[model samples]
Target: MKQIFAFMPTFLLSVIFCNAQKLTATDVNSPEVTVVVDIKVNPQFKSEVKSLVPELSALTIKEAGALSYNYYLSPDGNKILIIEQYKSLSAFQEHGKNLFSGPLGQKFRSSFTVNSIVVAGGNLPDSVGNFTVMKSIGGFNSKCE
Candidate 1:
């Protein structure tokens, strides 16, 4: 009984130490800037915008430190939302300059009658607290876990 007790403590201590020493990547990069841009295109620009999306996506994904670059269309299909992320401020600036004078940019400018273009740098806010957790799942009652 004494030997078993002694072995149990040692095993428990080893497990605790192993779990406590779990290390994560220290070099992971966070979003340098999150650009939430709203672009309104003229009704006639729809075809042009659709044609250019693939080219724009390819160019953006190839850029250095490009994290997430996605564009979404609104319900009316006339408004566009662009969310872009970069690893650092310098990468973002370089991309911005390159994009403005690059072929894709020219195409975009010529195609769309932009109602507004808003570019700002910030991180997206967390919404964990806004979510509700259901206590239990039941019949006819929707439960979220």
Candidate 2:
């Protein structure tokens, strides 16, 4: 009983220190940044919009800096979630150029009722808003076979 209480404080301290140290050490080195987009489309547009996911992803992945671009449909079928990863800030910026200014991106915009974006990374882009940024902890990103 006494030993358990004594170890609790030590355990907590270790956990805090380990997490802090880990965040400090590698957060800057984590160059991969991601954009998560949540889209709610008018029901009439749902089927048409869903069909375009592969097209968008395919074009995005062909770019030099895109690590991955995937879109998922919510079970209820009204919402779409797009997860896009890039190798660096510059890559993300390059994506931003197409996202608003290009024809394919216009198609993406025309499909959704509401499009909310959240950028997550060690460093957030200054030009974008509405982000849920975070320091990297630890994880591995592997390509799907």
Each candidate's TM vs. the true structure? 0.56, 0.67
Clashing pairs in 2: none
- Count the clashes in each prediction: 0, 0
Residue-level lDDT tens digits of model 2 in 59-89: 7777799988888888788898888889886
- Cα RMSD (angstroms) for every candidate in the order listed: 17.4, 10.7
- Model 1 has an lDDT value of 0.62
Worst 10 residues of 1 by lDDT: 132-141
Q: lDDT of all predictions, in order shown?
A: 0.62, 0.73
The sequence of per-residue lDDT tens digits that candidate 1 reaches over residues 69-139 is 88888767788888777776567667777788887787777666555433333332332123221221112
Candidate 2 global CA lDDT score: 0.73
TM-score of 1: 0.56
